[model samples]
Each structure stands twice: as C-alpha cells, then as structure tokens.
Target: MKILCGSAGWTDKTLIACKRFYPADCRTAEARLRFYASQFPLVEVDSSYYGMPSAANSALWVDRTPADFTFDIKAFRLLTGHQTVRESLPKDIAMAIPETGKKNLYYRDVPAEVLDELWRSYREALEPLRNAGKLGAVLFQFAPWLMCGPKGNAHVEECADRMQEYTVAVEFRNESWLNDRHAFDTLELLRRRKLVHVIIDAPETVTNRAHTLWQVTNPELAFVRLHGRDAEKWNATGAPTAAGRFDYDYSDNELAQISGPIRDVSRRTAKTHVIFNNCREDQGQRNARTLMKILGR
Candidate 1:
C-alpha cells in the first residue's frame, strides 16, 4: 500500500488541486470532507490533536468516507505528551488525582492510572474506522521535550508497548530518535514491537535531522511528513513551528532525494503514505500534486 500522495487535513486558506483535507475545516465540516473525498482516495485527519471525536462525529466520518477511501489519524495530544492537564477527577469527586496537574513523558507529569485510562478511552474512538476498514496509522508525534537518551528510549519503549497492546502503527518526533549515528536499538525495538516509524522530511538544519522512517520492514504502510525545508526558520529558532517561511519549494534535486527514500522503503513494502506538512501555504499540497504527476499515481 504505497501511498503516492496525500495532504494534511487542515482548513487552510491556500487552495490546492487534486484534493484538500479539511482537518478543522468545520466551517463546512461535512461538506469539506465530502469535497475532499470526491477528489482523493485518502485523507489524514488531525482530529486526534483535539482529542478523540465524539461518537456522533465518528459515525459521521464513517458515513462520509467511501468504502475505498482511507483516513490516517494522529493520536490525541492527551495520549501523547503534546498537551498537559490536571487529569481532573470526576465531577462528583472534585479532588482525587494529582493536584500538581502533572503531564506525561512529553509534557506534564501523569499517573500511570491516568495514562491507562486515557489510552483505553481514545483507542475506543478508532473502533469505527477499524470496523469500516478505514483506520490509518496512529501517528504519535511526541513533544520536543522528549529529547532522546535513556529517558527517550524509555518513552519509546513505553509507547511501543502501548501500541503493541493496541495493535497499531506509530510515529515519533525528536531528532535524537531518528539520528543515524544513534544506536539501532530503538529502531529494532520498533521493529520487534511491530510499530511503524513516522518518516519525517524537513530541511536539514540544526533543529531538523535527516531521518529515514523505514524501520518497519514490511512498509505495509509507510508514513512520511514533509515539514517543509525552511532551514533558516528551523536553524534560527531551533523550533519547527517558528514563523511560516513559505519562500521555498521542493526543488527537483530535493524531490529526487526524497523519492529515493520512498522508493527504497516501498521497494519491499506493500503500501506507502506520503503527507506534506510543509502546508504552511500550498507548498506541501503542491509537492504532493507534483509527485503524483511525476510518479503517475
């Protein structure tokens, strides 16, 4: 299942051809979804960012996406350490969990019990997609604070453990984890756990490392995210979310480099999914169209 093309589902102002995923395009949510589905066979929903969608929303998504199309959803922020909260107790109890309002390995501190509850609850949300055969990989884009080391490896182990418990593909952030110089223990760990690595494509900069997410040998589902090649923005702030510098596009050379990696991984796999997050404007979308045209997908 090599994914020739795909775009991040966000209601951006930039208009793109082929198709558009309205992740938060709730302005005309259903219509946006339908519109995109009409043009593309797949969509990567950012719904997990805001936490699992309600049952009604899930039902709506199931009803909207055609049987042949697909939806790749990232894991919720809560499940990962991208967000933090007090792990509030029930309305009746008022005070039970941590008052420090701890996070998780990515952010605030959280009790194991809270994490267990959160993971189980969110896992349930994917049931509809699973049942419909539309469930894509669960990308767990861990927070930047999750710097790699002994601690990072521990986090990886924990995440892998959870994914195995749930039986899903996963993705990772933090350059340390992707560094080729680093040991392959982590990569092997993912392989053993049967977790899919989320290959990242961003400009080579101090903040961005050249990482290949093809650890999962099968490549049944290759996940690639083009975070844009804004080297200056990344190098200057050491942050990927600095300002939007939509001044560059994937040159032939750059795309050539990427196509190789995709081909390398896909050569042995069944399917691949390439997403363009350089979507500050229509950069990612444009690249996707170009790749589609070039690859004749």
Candidate 2:
C-alpha cells in the first residue's frame, strides 16, 4: 500500500485543538511537507473541506513537492454531506433544524434541482486539483446513515458520471453493504467503470463504525483510512474528541496483519493507496511514518 499521511505544519492551536497529532512545535506547511515527502511518497489533503482551492494554491502545492511525489484530495463537504437533498424537504425538515445540527437529512426531500446544483458545484471545486495533476479520486465517503439501497446505487452511478471530469472513488459507512447483493453489484459496477474503491478501516465494534478497512478486492488503486478504534464514544456528540484523540498505531506485528491482503490485491491491481486518517494531533503523522518504515518505502 502506498502510505499517505494527513495534514502537517499545524499550529499550536491546531495541536491543542486537535490534540491527537499536534506537536509542541512544528514548522511551516511547505517545510513540513518537504520533510514528510522525503519519507513518504504521497499525502492525503483533508483541508479542502470548505471548497475548491484557487489555482495559485494548487500550483503552490505542486511546486512544493518533488516530481515523483503525489497527493490525494478529498471531495468537498457538499458532496460528502449529500447536500443535494437539502432542497424540497418539508418546512419542518428544512428550517426545522440548525445548520450546525448533526441531523442526517438536514433539509432532505427537496427537489432534484438542489442535487443538480450540488453536482455542478462539486465539479467546479475539483477543477483546480485536476488541472494541477494533484487530484486523486473524488473520495465519495457517505455517512453511516447512508445505507445501501437502489437509491444509493443510482446516486453512486451519478457520482461516477459527475466524476467524468476527474477520478471518483467511493467509501461506504453503512455495513448493510457487506452482505447484500447490491454491495457486490456496486463493486462490480465500480470495477467495470475503472473507478477506484476506497477501502476503510475503523473500530467496527463502536456505534456506527464506518468500515473495517478499504477492501482491496479488485486490482484497481486502493484507498484506505485508519480511523482510530475509539469504540466507546463513537456515537456521542463528543465523538470527534475520541475520533481525533486516541492513538492507534500499528505495531510491527499488526503491520504484518495487513501486508498479505495488500500484497494479494497488488498481485492484480495497478497501484494501491493506504491513508492514515488517525486525526489525533500527531498520531496520523506518527503512524504514517511507521507504515512507511514497515513498507520499506
């Protein structure tokens, strides 16, 4: 698996605010990125949460990295949140909730127009990344409530279509996808389309755990995220505390636990990607380095 680390060059506030991976001190983004690339070949940028970046920003990122280094960009929040459904919901569902509320379908049941607008916005935001050759897959990560169903498959298809402008990779939070034929069908469709499948790894015993790991069943590129195993507070409002708090480093033995599956997939796939989403202050940074050491990259 190609090891990729999370954000670096965080401030002290970011450290205390995040607490998981923050150091007492760190350097600038460019300096830290250069240092990191010297160890790992790729990075997964999670900072593009608000929207697409300006062209200048993407250029700056490219210039900072060596020609051989690469970056994986996460999709916009609007895409991740299923913002298209915010239209058309009844007034109760629409204005009934607060913007900051963690409601599943904030303003769902709205018209398809909202979805269309969202899809358009999604494309616009990804353009800069694509133009810079820094764009990876449009990580279509769904919330746990987004269970697998006919509707989801349609949306998945549409996601791939919308991604014609770039690479599209999907990650499922709902486990109903595990046994259902729909899951296999969806996987087959993704394989046929040559879109990447993002395998996820998280503490499965927790309430609403996202995924066990990025299942590298196919030979396409693999994208995996290791969200720490904070099984207790997973469902509470304070989840991000644990989510971005605990350290879940893979010991040398545990790294062996994953090597075979990765190699098995690599036997067929062109390239594989493993992302450490351990958002705890510096755990992601630390774990990423450990993974690179283990992988001898």
Candidate 3:
C-alpha cells in the first residue's frame, strides 16, 4: 500500500508570510508548488472551494509538479451546499442571477441550466490534471448542518453521480453521520456508491464535530484530513478565518499516536492520502514531514 502525506494547500498567507517552509527564491506560485512537490508526493487544492478553478491554472499545475505527484481538489462551495458569495461565481453566471439583492447563493438558489454549466466547467477545468494522471480525488465536504437523513443521503448520492468520471471523496462535518446510531449506514452508503470516505482528525471537544472514523469504504483510496485539535478556535463565534480555525500544531506524540490507525487503513486501500489541514503558518508542512518520517514513507 502507498501512503501519500502532504498539506491541505501550498499557498496560505501565513505559511508564506512566516518564511519557514518555502525558500527565499520560491516567491512565485510556480516556484512554491514545485518546491512543495519536491518535499511531498501529494497536496489538496483548497482555493477551488472558494471559487471556480480555471483550466489554464489546472494545466499549469500539471506542468509544474512531478509525474508522480497528485492533487486532491476541494469541490466548489455551491456544489457542496455551502453558502457562496456572488463574486465567487463566474461573471456570466453571476449576471444570470436576477437582481434579487441576494448576496449569498446556495445550491437551490441557482437555476438548473446555470448549475449544469458549473458542473461541466468544473469537470473541464480538472481535465488537465486527470489526463496527466495527477488528479487524486474531488473532495465533497458537506456542511455541518447536513445531518444524516434521507435528504442528506440523496444529496451525497447526487454529488457522487455528478463527479462519476473521477475519484470522489466525501467528508461530512456533522456528527450525526458517524455517531453510534448512523455510522454503519453512512459507511455502507459510501461503499455502495464507491465513494472514498474521508477520515478526519479534528477537535473532539467541539459540538457537531465529525469524529475520526478509521473505516475505509473504497478499496482504491482512503483519505485522511487532520484538522488540529483546537476546541476554542473550532467552537469560536463570529467569522473565523481558515487559519484561525485550524491553527493548532500536532506534537510528536500526537503524530505517533495517530500513525497506527493511519497505517492500518493504508493496508486495506491501494493508496491512502493523509492531508494536514492545520494550516497556520508552516504547521501543516512541518507536521506532514514529521508524519512521513514516523511512517517511514
């Protein structure tokens, strides 16, 4: 089994601003990506979740990274049932929306034709990565309110169907999906749909937090995203930036403790992707490197 360890995204304001991970010469986007790939075999594209990814940028990623390197892209906010801003949408698509004075748009707010176009464009943009065999998986991280129920199940199935051509990973933020009552059903659902179950490591003390489930639904791939255990930030009120929410760093003992389950899950899948989402400054980069050493990858 192959275990690929890396960070959620290469470009983070604090990661670059801290001047700890990237070299002094690695100022350009291309340079940073190239340098990151040299250190790790995998990475997750976090920016795509905020806005539509461009085909040109996708092609540039393929050209910049090595052949064996791969990227797991986060699905667009609209596709994942997240509240997206008008500016995040394409200019033409945003114009299509009637002047309803709505600043935020959800999946239901978008017209059928416009949504179809979005799905098509999203798929087309990632074609370069898929064609070059650099695509890892399209991550569909459902919102916390998406509880385990019929409607939620249907939405999950729909997302899998939409990205049927590519490898899809599902991450549920709600605890209901993996609680004692519905854990079995949730795993079964993913297994039946051939969707990779994303195992997350997050603050256990927080309400509605998804507990770390070591179960692997897809034999082809198992995804693990480590969001450091900082209950205060995770449970904070008001709007919290990505960095502030996932700012805690993993200690050596913490990494060693989790390595066992990670190794066990890797054995059952063809490949396992372990992504560090504790993206405060260079925390993820440093933690991922340490985990790689622990796993002897």
Candidate 4:
C-alpha cells in the first residue's frame, strides 16, 4: 500500500515553541521547510486557507523541498464558501466588487468576474508545485452550513469543474451530507466526480458529528484527517478559535483503533494520505509520528 503520513501544517506556533522536532539552526522559513521535508514526505498547507498563496512562494517551496516531497493545499476561504472579511480580499478583487457597506462576503456575494479572477490566481499560484510534481491535491473543505441538497451539489460540481486540471479532495463539515439515507448517494456523487472523499476522526459528541463517517468514496486517492477527539471544545462557542477547538492528543489505544482502517483503505487505493489536524502543540506531530511507527511506514 502507498501510504503517506503527515501533519496538517508545519508552521504551528506550538510546534516551534515545543523545540522538539526542529533544530535551533532551522529558524528561517527555508531552513524549517528543508528540515521538515527531511522528517516527513508530505504536509498540508493550512495557511493557504487563511490567505491567498503567491506563485513566488510556491516556487521557493519547490526549491526548498526534496523531489519526493508532496504538498496538499487547502482551498482559499472564498473558494470554499466561507464568510471572509472584506479586507481579506485582494486589492484588485476588492476594488472590482461593489461594496454595500458589508463587513464580510460569502461566495454568493462575490461577482462572477471577481470569483473568476480569484480562481485563476489560485490555480496559477500552484503551477510551480505542479510543474515540480510536488503537488498532491487541493482540498476543498466546505462550511458546516453547506448541507446536502441540489444547491450543495451544484457548488461541489462547480468547484470540481473549475479545478479539473488538478486532483481535488472534498471534505464536508455538515452532517447532512452523510447520514443513513444519504451516505451511499453522497459517496457515489464524489466517486462520479473523481473527488477524493476526506475521511475524518473528530469528537463524536458535537452537533455535526455526522462527519465522523469513515467510508472511502474514491479509489484513486483516499484521505484520512485525524482531528483529536476533544469533545468538550469541539463545539464550544466560547472557545477563542480552532486551535482551542481541536486541542487533544490521541492515546496509543485510540491510534491503534484507527490503524486497521487506515491500512484497509490504503490497500484499496492507489495512494492514501493520513494527516493529523490536532495542531495544539506538537500533539499533532507527535500523534502522526506515532501512527507512522505503528504502521511501520
């Protein structure tokens, strides 16, 4: 089985502060990336979800990492239909849009021209990685409110069509997308579109726990993202941010329980990517390394 194990992102402040994985000389971005590439073959670009990435930076990344290293980039906030701040948009995009004194803009609010520009820029930014054969996939994780229905399906199809040149992975945060009645059909939809279904392990007590379903939808590439089971903070409205929400470490037994399923999925697919999203400290990295040891990868 072709299994790639990694953490969601390498730049977490907690990972740096822990001073466990990186050497002191690995301080700058290039040094850190070089060191990280030495340790892991894959990494997910979580920062790209917060802001648009530059082509120059992407090219620099290709130069810094080894040829075998691969990157899975998160889709930009706007592309995934999240509530993005008006100020977060690029200057050209902001100027092109008609401002109605709104503080935030949803994917629906953006004009067609602005959306096209944003999509074009995102694809262009990834060209360097793609050319170097370091680009694994572009992950499109939809918001919790994006339920299963005609509208939701349309949006998913539109995203797939726009990025048809690249491999796309789809992750749904909403429970409605996967239930007893909808699970098979939803998986079939992703299969038909050639979208890699993102399997996740998160707190099961949350209102949106339906996303915990672990079925494989695409045979080309399967993904498993382990977000530690922190039930208390999973849906805590008082929590400051996602950093707090996903703050938990997996025990040996918990990780052991997942090992079988991961191996099973990897055996059936061309490649399987297992990423840890529990980035509270070095917790995600630690758990990911532990899993790698368990799988003997």
Candidate 5:
C-alpha cells in the first residue's frame, strides 16, 4: 500500500508569515512550491474551492512540482451546493447570469447551459495535471446543510456524473450522512458510485459535524483530513478566516495514535492520502512531517 501525507494547501498566509517552514531565500510562489514539493509528495488545492482555477496556473503547477507529486483539488463552492459569491464566477459567466437581485450564487440558481459551461471550464482547467498524471482526486466537500436525504443524494450523484472522467472523492460535513441510521446506506452509496470516502478528523463536540469513520468506499484510494480538535472554534460564529476555525497543532502522541488507523486504511486501498488542514502558522506542515515520520514513510 502507498501512503502519501501532506497539508491542505501550501500557501496559507499564516504558514508563510510564521517563517518556520520555508527557508529565508524561498520567497516567491515558484520557490515556495518547489521547496514544499521537496518535502511532501502530495498537497490539497484549497484555493480552488473559492474560485475557478485557470489552465495556465495548472500548467505552471505541473512544471514546478516533481513528476511523482500529486495534487488533490477541492471542488469549487458553486459545484458543491455552497453559497458562492457572484464575483467568484468567471467574469463572462457572471455577466451572463440574468440579473437576479441576489448577490450570492447557488447551484439551484444557475441555468442548465451556465451549469454545463462551469463544469466544462472546471474540468478543462485541471486537464494539465490529469494529463501529467499528477491529479490525485477532485474532492467534493458537501456543505453542512446538505443532509442525508433524497435531495442530497441526488446532488452527490450529479457531481459524480459531472466528474465521471476523474477520480472523485466525497467529504460530508453533515453528521446525518454517517449517523447511526444512515451510515450503512451512505457508505453503500459511495461504494456504488466508486467515490473515495474522505475520512475526517475534526472536533467531535459539534453536533452537526460528521463522525470520523475509517471505512474505505473505494478500493483504489482512501483520503483522510485532520482538521485538529479545536472544539471551541469548530463552530465559532464570525470567525475571521478558516485558519482561525482550524487552529490547533497535533502532539506526537496524537499523531502516533492515528497512525495505526491510517495504516489500516492504506492496507485496504491501493493508496491513501492523509492531509492536515490546520493552517495556523506552519502547524499543518509540521504535523504532516511528524505523521510521515511516525508512519515510517
């Protein structure tokens, strides 16, 4: 089994501001990516979730990283039924939308043609990475309101159909998806669609948060995201940034405890990707390195 450990994204503001992970000379974007690639074999593209990615940028990413390095891109907010800013859409697409009074865009608000265009553009943007064998998976992280019901299931199926050509991974934020009543059916649904189940390590104190389940829905790959155990901030209202929401570091003991389950999941799948999402001041990078060492990778 192959195990790849990495952070959610390489370019977090706090991660850079800390001045601990990167060398002093590595200041530019190119230099930072090259330096990060030298340390970790994989990375998750978190920025892509906020807005559409350009093909040119993806091509540049292909050039900067090592041949074996892989990138798991987070699905765009619009694609995953989240409330997206109107400006986040491509300028052309934004202009095309019939001037609704609303400032935000949701999946239900778009016309079929516009939806098709958005999906096409998103897939095209990642072509460079896919062609180069560096695209790991397109992660579809559903919103907390997306419950375990017919509507949510249909949406998941739609997303899977849209990205049928690529490796798809599903991360459910709502607890209902894996609750005592729906856990079996949810896993079965993912298994039927061949969607890689994304195991989350988050603050379990929140009632809405999904429980951490170690099962693998797709035998091809398994994904794990550690969001730290900061229960207080997990559901804190009016947080300034995601870093503030996911702000906790893993101790050596914590990493060692999770390493065993990660290894077990890796054994079941052909490959496993473990990503740290704690973006406070190089915590993810430091924790990822520690986990890698513990796993003897």
Candidate 6:
C-alpha cells in the first residue's frame, strides 16, 4: 500500500511562527515548500478555499517540490456553496456580482455565467499542477448547511462534471449525508461517480456536522483528514478563524485508534493520503509527523 502523510497547509502562519516545524532558513514561500516536500510526500492546499490559486504559483510548487510530491487543493469557498466574502474573490469575479454592497455571496446567489467563469478560473489555475503530475485531488468540501438530499446530490454531480479533467474528492460538513441510514447510499453515489470520499476524523457527535467515520468509497485513492476531536469548538459559530474551531491535538492513544482504520483503508486502496487538519499552531505538523512514525512510513 502506498500511504502518504502530511499536514493541511505548509504555509500556515502558526506553523511558521511556532518555529518547531520548519527550519529558520525556510522563511520564503519557496523555501518552506521545498523543506516541507523533503519531509512529507503530500500536502493539502487550504488557501485555495479562501481565494482561487494562481497557475504561476502552482507551477512554482512543482519546481520547488520533489518529483513524487503531491498537492490536494481545496475548492474555492464560492464553488463549494460556502458563504464567501465578496472582497476575497478575484477583482473581475467580485465586480461581476450584482449586489456589490453585500458582504458575502452563496453559491446559489451567483449567476450561471459568473459561476461558470469561477469554475474555468479554478481549472486553469490547477492546470499547471496537473500537467506536472503534482496534483493529487481537488477537494470539494461542502458547507454544513448543504444537506443530504436529491438537490445536494445533484450539486455534487455538477461539481464532478465541472472538474472532469482532474480527480475530485468530496467532503461533507453536513452529518445528514453520513447518517446511519444514508451513509452507505452516499458511499455508492461517490463510487458511481468515481469521486474520492473524504473520510474525516472529527468530533463524534451528530450536531458537529462532520462525522468521524472509517469509510473508503474510492479504491484508487483513500483520503483521510484528521480535524482532531475538539467537540467544544466543533460547532462554535462565533469562532473567528479555522484554528479556533480545529484547536484539539491528538494524544498517543487517539492516534493509535485512528492508525488501525488508516491501515485498513491503505490495504484496500492503491494510494492513501493521511492528512492532519488540526491547523492550530504546530499541532497539525507535529501530529502528522507522529502519525507517520506510528504508521511506519
């Protein structure tokens, strides 16, 4: 089994400021990526969720990393039906919006043409990485409000169709998608579409939206994201940033419990990506390294 381990983002501010993961010389973006690539085989690009990535940067990443290094980029917030701040979008995309005064816009609020443009822009941005064989999967992590049903399922198909050129991974924040009754059905949906099911390690509570389960829908690639078991902040609506919500760190026993499932998934899939998403300071980076050692990778 080809198993790769890494953290969500290498360029996270806390990971750099914490001064525990990267060396002092890894100050520049290029240097940081190069160093990170040397240590880990894969990385998840979380910044793309905030703003569309650039082709130039993607190309640079290819040049900076090792030949086997891979990047899994998150879908743009607007593309995933999340409430995106208009200002964070590209100038042209933002200007095209009818309600310029509004602070945020949902995926449904955007016009068809504008949404198509956004998709085009994202595809183009990732082309460089794809061409270089540095791209793993484009993650479409839908918002918690995007529930399970025919409508939600159709949207998933639409996203898959839009990115047909690349491998797509789907992560649902809505627990309804993975409830006891719908879990197997949802897995079948992903299997039929050849979409990588993003198995999550989050708070094991119904209200948390994300369910902590061991499921592998895609035999080609099993992608696991560990967001830690921070139940207190799992549904904390008032949290200002992602770090606040994913604040917990895994203890030794916690990692041991997850290790078994990861190994089981690895045996079934051609490749497995174990990504630690607890992006609070150096917690994720440390845990990723720890998990790697635990898994004997």
TM-score per candidate, chains pooled: 0.80, 0.75, 0.97, 0.97, 0.98, 0.96
Candidate 4: give the clashing pairs.
Answer: none
Top candidate (TM-score): 5
Candidate 3, backbone clash total: 0
Task: Give stretches of model 1 more than 4 Å off.
Answer: 13-27, 85-96, 101-108, 165-167, 208-210, 213-216, 235-248, 251-253
* lDDT (10s digit) by residue, model 1, range 1-297: 355577777455654332443444445767777766766666677756654544466678889878877777776665566653433322322233455533433333556666676566666777788788877777777776676678766776787677664435555556676677663866776677777767777665555454655555334666677777777765564556543643356876677667877777776667787877665656666677777666657
* lDDT string, candidate 2, 1-297, tens digits: 444444322322444466454233435666656666666666776655434434566667777777766677666555554553334332443453446544444224434666566556556655655666766656767655676777666666766787775666777777766544456765777787767777666666764644454355445467666666655545546554434434465566766676666565655566666777655556666676766666666
Q: Worst 10-residue stretch by lDDT in candidate 6? A: 205-214
Query: What is the per-residue lDDT of model 3 for residues 101-157, given as tens digits with 9 covering 90 to 100?
Result: 777888888888988888899999999999999999999999888889999999998
Q: How well is each residue in 1-297 modelled by candidate 4, as lDDT tens digits?
A: 888999989888988999988898899988988998988889999988988888998999999999999999999988898988867777888788888677888899888988899899999999999999999989998988888999999999999999999999988998888887798889999988889999999887777755666667777788998887878878778666767877888999998889999999888799999989988768888888888899998
> If both were scored by lDDT, which would come out higher, candidate 4 or candidate 6?
4
Task: Report model 4's TM-score to 2 decimal places.
Answer: 0.97
lDDT of each: 0.64, 0.59, 0.92, 0.88, 0.93, 0.87
On lDDT, the candidate that comes out on top is: 5
TM-score for candidate 3: 0.97
* lDDT measured at residue 223 in model 5 versus the true structure, 0 to 100: 97
lDDT of 5 by residue, 129-159 (tens): 9999999999999988999999999999999
Residue 184, candidate 3: alpha-carbon lDDT: 95
Compare candidates 2 and 4 on TM-score and give the better one: 4
TM-score sort, best first: 5, 3, 4, 6, 1, 2
Q: Count the backbone clashes (under 3 Å) in each candidate.
A: 11, 17, 0, 0, 0, 0
Give the per-residue lDDT digits (tens) of candidate 6, residues 57-98: 898988999888999999999889888888788899888878
- In model 5, where do residues sit more than 4 Å from their true spots? none
**Cα TM-score of candidate 5:** 0.98
